[model samples]
Every structure is written in structure tokens, then in C-alpha cells.
Target: MDGTIINSIASAERIWGDWARRQGLDVEKFMPTMHGARGIDTIRNLNLPGVDPAAESALIEKAEIADVDGVVPISGAIDFLASLPPERWAIVTSSPIALAKARLAAAGIPFPRFIVTAEDVKVGKPNPQCYILGAERLGVSPSECLVFEDVPAGIKAGEAAGADIMVITATHGHPVETPHSTISNYDGLHAHISDDGKLSVVRG
Candidate 1:
């Protein structure tokens, strides 16, 4: 739901920056690593000195909730999603249910019938579990699905699940060295997902 469905990175950075300031850490140093990661996972992976676990968890939750303010739809995301038949697509995000719903609603995007959130998976992105589960819930084989992702970890997950993955460069700066195809936005993604489930990109 983050950089893909909604561009919440700026809000996330601001919230995390405030948390880092209160903890006497350099916000700039930590924010990069925090991007595209689950809130709790970001805290655990920090490996920072003198960081309190409970306080960190509370702060992260607060930041996540605070970020609800500036959520905006990514360019062409809504149109792309709406153009597809509901049965052919699903959302596999690292966000929990409430946040996902809030962001989607705020962006005025139609919620997918099948969604696999961070809370629903044993492992998050780069693990393939969430994408795999989303395909299962949608009753579609992984090979028949096309995934739109904005981060390397999510790209890895979808590709590992045998889906045709398309990386959006809005998040994570530029595309990483993943094998999946990359696009600047979702503008022409609909034509790419054809009737037989074969994927193609028509560049203009």
C-alpha cells in the first residue's frame, strides 16, 4: 500500500524523523534503511545502541498512524487497477489491514477482493509468502499473475513466486538489479495484461 498504491514516503520520513530526534539518533542515517520495511522489522534491524525495544515499537506505531495525513494515489495506479477485472488482480502489501484500507479509501481506489497484508503472512517481502498467499486466495496460479511492485524486496517476492513482476520506480529511487521489467508508472499497464494472462509492455 505504500509507494505503489499511495505515495506516503514523505509522510513516513517526517514521522520517523521525529521519532529519531526524540531518541537522539540521526534521522537521515536511519530513514533510508527503514524504507520498504515493516515498522517492527525496521526497529529490530536498526541494531542501534541504547535503543529501547518497547519505546521503539510505540514510536513506530505512532509514526505509522501519523502518516495517514498526506496519503495520495500514485500516478495512474487507480486507472490501471480499475481497468482490470477484479478476479485477475489482488493486492499483496506489507501494510496491515487497517492502514491498507485507510490508504486505499483515501486514494479512492477500489479495494481488491483478495489482499494479503503483513499481518496475514508469516514472512514479509523478499520471502515470497505474501505474493504466494495472494495468488492462492485469488484462486490463480502464481505463473498466471502479474505483480506491480515499488521496491526490490517486493519485486523479489513476486518474481520468486513465478509471477510476471513489474517494478514502479516511484519508490526505492530507481529500479534495483532485479530480473523483472521496470516502468516509470502504471499508465499503460492494462494493455500489458492480456486475455490469456500473457504480459507485455507497450512503450510510447
Candidate 2:
């Protein structure tokens, strides 16, 4: 939800950049793979010896919760989300629940009734567990879900879950790796539901 619904790019960069520096890693390589990755998963993937993923993740989450200074809703995100039927959508984020809730509150966005966070699943993005759980919680088949994502990992997870994926391009100057339609933000978009239980989004 960082770049998709919430404008927390700067805050995230600050926090994660510090983490990278502390790990003696190059921020250049660190950031390119930052989006849609859980902190613990990322730490483990970095293959840093002697680093405890869970411990580091807790520390990172603490920093994130305290670093909500610039967090705010993405343009049009509020209206777009408010327009959706509550049961039709849910947040599937790579952040822990505490960090997710903190970011949502900082952005003035209400917490989604159904949320799947990093802590909710054993595996993180690119594995589809989060998206699968999200669809299940929303009482819908994965094929019936349309995922709005900002990172390659999220796109991959959505695809693996059998959902159509759309990339949000606010953080990146161009689209990342999602092989799907991309939008800069929620602008000019509207969602509709048909009598036959089909959901469609139109660009206005």
C-alpha cells in the first residue's frame, strides 16, 4: 500500500536507506528491490550473515511507525477507495499489521475491514500467499479480483493468485515490471459492478 494508496515513498526511503547503510549494503541495489518486499524477507534475501530477520524486522517496523511524518493518501486514493463496496476490496500489504495501521492512520485513510499483512502469511510477495488470503477473506475467487500494485513482486503475486494486476506509477518515473496496464494514480478511474457479479473498472 506504500505507493498504491499511500504516499510514503520518502519516509520509506529514509528508513530503509538507513537500514541498508547499517548493513554495509549499497542503497542503489537495495532500493530497486525494495517495493513490495517484507522487511524480514528482504533482510533474509540479502544473505547477511548473523542478522536475525525477525529481530531486524521488528526494529524496522518500530522505525517505520515513528517515521510517519510525511505519510498521506495518494491523490484520488481516498475518493476511489471510498467509492468501492466495502466487501469488494481488501488491502494486501507486505508490511506488518502495526506498520500498516500506522501508515493508514497517518494518511487519513481508514483501515480496510479486511487486510492481509506480512505477518498474516508464512510467505511474502511473489509467493501469492498474501493475495490468496486477501481474496479468501473477501469471499471471492482470485480470478474475480483486480489487484492494484506498485511493485514487481506484488504484480507477480497477483498473477500467481489468478487476479488481474494493474501497476501504480506514482513512485516510479515509469512502470516497473508488471505485464499489465498501469496508471499514475487513481485519477480518471471508476469501478462498476454488473448484475452478473462481474466487476469492471473504467477510465474516465
Candidate 3:
């Protein structure tokens, strides 16, 4: 999801930025840190004085679901995803279920049949738990899966889970640290599945 299948940056920044201002934190310093993290975890990490992490996290979830304006699919994401077999793919996102579905719907991306959201696992990204669970739910080994991620935490999770990783540069459009591959977006890439069930990616 987010920055991969859907471009929810506008809404995400708006909501999180507002939260930061309300909490008297530096929005510039705080914004990037929030990506690829669960809301609850993010709040706890902030460690703001006089704030309840759990309550704030719940509020953020509500805000994210309600602020779906400007959410849209990343370029070529819809077509590229449609070309793949559903059973071979799953979205392992740090977003909660409601926000994930709302973003997908707003972006016109079909909600994935196999999705692991923040609520689905005890620990979030960079822990490998969610990604591992995703592979398990997809009925595949970790080595058999390819994860597309935008942020460092998600990339680390995919790596820790023993899956190949493709870092999407849509968020910052900069080189990442040691990803298996990097793509600007889903544009100009082709996915092919052999009769023997081998998947191949070709750059067009």
C-alpha cells in the first residue's frame, strides 16, 4: 500500500502534520519518521509529554480514514497489479486495516485478497513479523515472495523475512540502501508468469 499501490502522501502528511503541530513537535523532523510505522508505535516513539500514546494513535487512525481526499493510485500501479495473479501477491502494509482499505478504494486499486495490516500482527515493520505472516497467508515460502516497499523500515522487514525486495522511489525518488531492485514506479515494467509458475520481471 501507500507510496506503492496508492499515493496517499497528501492525506498522510496533512493528518500527521496536524498531529505534530497539536503536540508542538517539529513537523519537518517528525513527518518522515512516521512513514512505514504503525500509529501506535509512532506515538510511543514520540514519547510526548502529557500525551496518551494509545489514545492519540486511535485518533490518528480515525483522521486517516476520514481524510481520503487526493488519494490516488501510483502511476501504472493499477494496470501492473491487474496483470499479476492475485494469489501470487499480497500487501504487507504498516497501515491499519481501515486506513488501508480506504486508501485503496480512493485510489481505485482493488483491495488485495491477502493483506497484512498493522492490526494483523503484534509487531509492525522492521520486525519481519508482518512480512513473514504475509508469506504464510499467501501459502508461499518467504524466498518465493517479492516485496515492494518505499521506506527503510519496510525494506528491512522484507529483507529480514528472506524475501526479495524492490524499493519504490515514489516517496522520495532517491537511492535506497541495498535493495534487491529499485523502481521509480510501476511504469514500464512487465510481469510474466511461466507455465511452470516462475515469475519474471522485464523492464520495458
Candidate 4:
């Protein structure tokens, strides 16, 4: 959600950079992997000695929730999301529910009826389970889902879940290498549902 529909890189990096420094880690090496992942899962993966992943993640979430100063919706994201059927589109985000809501509000995006947030999943991105569950809960097969993602792990997750993907490059600091379709934003795109109820997103 952050990278795909919302651009919160400045706020995110500020908070995460602080966390990295606190852990005496290199920010450049540490920051990239943090995007498109649950904060707790990211912290847990670090295996930092004497660190409580849950607590550390909670702290980070609090900071992010409170720091939405530069958070803004990607160009055309708001209108694009509004154009889609609420039940047909779900936000499969790695952020905790509170933080997700906060960020969405900051970006002026409404809450979708169904959101597969970090709390709803047993595992996070790159695991396929999150996206798979999202598809299942939305009453669609994974192959019927079209995921918009901005990070490699998320793209891999969508691929593993048998879903098509569109890479959003709006917030990328450097070129993202992906074979999947790419879009800088939701501009010039339109969402359509056929008579049979199959959703199709097309570039206008």
C-alpha cells in the first residue's frame, strides 16, 4: 500500500533510518529490504540479539502512524481506487491495521471494505500466503487477482501466488528491474468489469 498507492518513503526512511542507527546497522543496506514487509517480520528476520521483535515493531509502527507529514497518494491512485468496486479490490498490506489506516487517511484514500493487513496473515510478503489468503478472502482464485506492487519481494509473492502483477515505480529511488508490467502511477488507467464479472485493468 505504501509504495504502490501511497508514497511515504521520506517518513518511512526517517523512522527506519533511526531504527537502523539505533541498531548500529548501515542504513543503505538495511532500508531497502524493509519496504513491502511487516515491521515485526522485518525485525525478526534481523535476529538482533537482545531485541524483542514485537516490541521494536510496535514502536516503529507508532512512529510511522504519527509521522505522516510527507505521506501522499501516488498520482491518480485516489481516483483509480475509487473507480474500482470496493469488494473487488482489497489492500494487501504488510502494515499493522492501525498504521495502515493512518497512512491511508494521510494519503486521503478511503478504507476498502476488505483489507488483508498484517494482523490478518500468519506470514508476510514474499511468502505467498498473504496474497493467497487475500485472493481467497476476496472470493477469487489467485490467478484472478491482479497485484500492484513496488518491491521485489512483493512481486515474487504475487508470482508465487499465481497472480499477475503491475510494478509501481513512483517511489523507487533507482530503476526497478522486473519483467512484469510497470506503471509510474495510476494515471491513464481504467478499471473494468466484464458482464461475467471478470475484472480487467487497462491502460488508457
Candidate 5:
């Protein structure tokens, strides 16, 4: 729900950039690769020679907490979510539980009834574990769930899980490729959720 439901990418980038700079690392090269990765996995993939793992963990933790206050809900997200039947939706995120909760609470977003966090999944986005788990937790088959994602990795995960995915260009700054459909904003998302529980973009 982070980048899609709440516009937290700028805040996330700023926090990671500051942390990377303090560690004498190249934020530009590192931040992009870390975008949709699990928190600890992002640090591990950095493979910074001579860097202390414990210190990196501490830095990431602090930065994520500090950035929470800067998160804002995407325009129309609240109304779109409100219009849906909660039982049919869920949040599958790469964020660890603590950081996810912080960002959601900061953005004043209601906690999703079914949530699958990075901590709960063995594999992260681009692997589909989170999305699959979310579908399971919601008592729905993957094919019946409609995933809303802002990044290619998240979109890939949803697709891999057999769900029809919808792309929201929030964090990626470009369109994500998804087989089902895409929307620039959540303004028409409610209409897209049909009576049969399938989602489709409303044509003009």
C-alpha cells in the first residue's frame, strides 16, 4: 500500500539517500535497486565492502521511522478504498511490519483487514510470495484477487500469483506493464471493481 495507496516514494528516497551518503555510498546507484526489495535484503544487496551490517540495519531503521511523518495518502485513495468491500481487498507489501505500520498510520490510512508483510513472506516482490499470501489470508484464490501496485516488481509479483494487476504510476515515474489494466489515479477505481469482483478500467 505504500507507494500505491500512499505517496511515500519521495520520503523513502530522501531517507535512504541520507543514510547512504552518511555511509559514504552512492545513493543513486543503490536506491533504485533497493526500491521494491525487502528492507534487510536491500541492505544485503548493497554488499558494501567494509560496512558493518549492524550499523546499516540501525541506520535504515532510524531513517524509516523519521520519514513516516512525511508520507501522504495518494489522492482519491481513501474514497476508492472506502467504496470497496474490505473482505475482497488486501495489502501485500515489501516493507517490514513496523515501517509499514508507521507509514500507513502517518498517512492516516486505515489498516487493511488482510495484510501480507515482507516479514511474513519467505520471498519478496518479483517472487509473488507476499501477494499469494495475501490472497490466502483473505480467503480468496490468487486468480480472484485484484492487485494494485506502483512498481514493476510488485506488478510482477501480482501477476505471478495469478491475479489481475492494476498499475498505479506513483513511485516508478513511468508506466508499469500489467496484463489486466492500468490507471493513472484512483479516481475511477470504484467503478472498476465490478459486481462479480473483477476489476476493469472504465472506458470513456
Candidate 6:
């Protein structure tokens, strides 16, 4: 849900940056690697000596769940989401359930009827498994879904799952280079369902 439905970057960076400093890693270098992936996988990828990825990840999740000070919905995210049929949409996020729900509540966005959180997946973003599962749970084929993402990992995951991608750049600090369609936020966009039940996103 982060970056797509809600902007949690401030809270995310604050907690992760603190963790990186405690780990004696360069915060700038480590910060970019943390987003769009599970905390445990991100920690494991560091391959730090004597660090338990699971433990570190759990701690990070706890901090994330508590730090909702700056978490808020992307502009127009609330109404845009409300405009869609609930069953036709699902949040597939790399965040664990508690953290995910916390952020969504903090952002004032409705909790999705169903969500694929970090706790539900063996592999995280860029694996395509999460998105694939999301589509399956929605009773739709991957090719029939339009996945919204911000980071490279999530974009890659959506593409790998064979779904059309719409990149959300509202919370992106750096320019995201993607050939797929892009939007700054959900503003002015509407979801339309035809009689055939095909969903199309239209811009005002």
C-alpha cells in the first residue's frame, strides 16, 4: 500500500535510518535498498555477521507499526479508492499485516477487504508471487489486472506477474524511469466498470 495508496516514506525512512545507524551501516546507502521489499529479506541481503534477519525484521515491523506520525494518504487516494468496487481491488504490499493496517488507518484509507501482506508470502516483491496471489484472490487473471506501483522492485513484480502497470510517483524522491503509464497520484482518475465487468481507469 505504501507509495501507491499511502505515503509512508517519512515514517519508513525515520525508522529504517535509525536501524541502519545502529547496525553501523551507511544510512544513505542502506535506505534505498530497504523500500519495495520485506525487512527480513533486505536485512538478509546485507549478510551482516551475526545478525538474525527474522529478529531484526520483527523489530523493524514493531517500530513501523508504532511510528505512524507522518503516515497519510496520497492526494485523492481516499476518494479514488472509495470509487472502486471493493472486490475488484486488493492491496498487495511488502509490509506485514500490523504495519500495513496501522499505516492504512493512519492515512485514513479504508482497510481493503483482503490484502496480501508480507506475512502472507514466502518471497517478497520482485518475486511476482505476491501479485499473482492477489490476482488469484480477486478471481481475476493477472493479465486482467492493472497493478499500481512506485519502486523498481514493485514495478518489476507487477510486470513479472503479467499485469499492466501504472506507476505512482507521488512519494518518489528520485525519478522512476518506466515505460508503463505513470501518475503523480490518484487525483482526477476514475475507475469505470463496463457491463462486461472490465475495469478501466479513466482520467478526467
Name the candidate that leads on TM-score: 6
| Full-model lDDT, candidate 2 | 0.88
Question: Model 5, 122-145: lDDT tens per residue?
Answer: 767789888878889988799987
Tens-digit lDDT track for model 2 on 1-204? Answer: 888999898888899999999989989788878778998988889788999988998998999999998998888898888778888889999999999999999999998889999889998999998998999999988988889988878888999999988888887866365559888888767778789977787768
Deviating ranges (above 4 Å) for candidate 2: 175-178
Q: List the residue pairs that clash in candidate 4.
A: none
Candidate 1 per-residue lDDT over residues 54-133, each given as its tens digit:
46766666557656777788878887777666776788887767767877787788788888886897767788988889
Count clashing residue pairs per candidate. 0, 0, 0, 0, 0, 0
| TM-score-sorted candidate list, best first | 6, 4, 3, 2, 5, 1
Which lDDT tens digits does candidate 3 get at residues 1-204?
888778889999999999999888989999989988898888988777889988998999999999999999888898898888888889988898888888899999988889999889988888999999999999989989888988888888988999998888877745666636788888877689889989877767
Superposed Cα deviation of residue 48, candidate 3 (Å): 1.8
Question: Over the stretch 28-77, how does candidate 6's per-residue lDDT look in tens digits?
Answer: 88888998999999999999999999999999999989899999999988
Reference-based lDDT, residue 151, model 3: 89
Enumerate residue pairs that collide in model 1: none
What overall lDDT, based on C-alpha atoms, would model 4 receive against the true structure?
0.92
Worst 10 residues of 5 by lDDT: 195-204
TM-score of every candidate relative to the true structure? 0.83, 0.95, 0.95, 0.97, 0.86, 0.98
What does the lDDT read for residue 74 in candidate 5?
Answer: 85
- Candidates in order have lDDT scores of 0.74, 0.88, 0.87, 0.92, 0.77, 0.92
Span of 10 residues, lowest total lDDT, candidate 3: 171-180
Backbone clashes, candidate 1: 0
Q: Cα RMSD (Å) between model 3 and the true structure?
A: 1.3
lDDT of 5 at 152: 69
- Candidate 1: residue 202 Cα off by (Å): 5.9
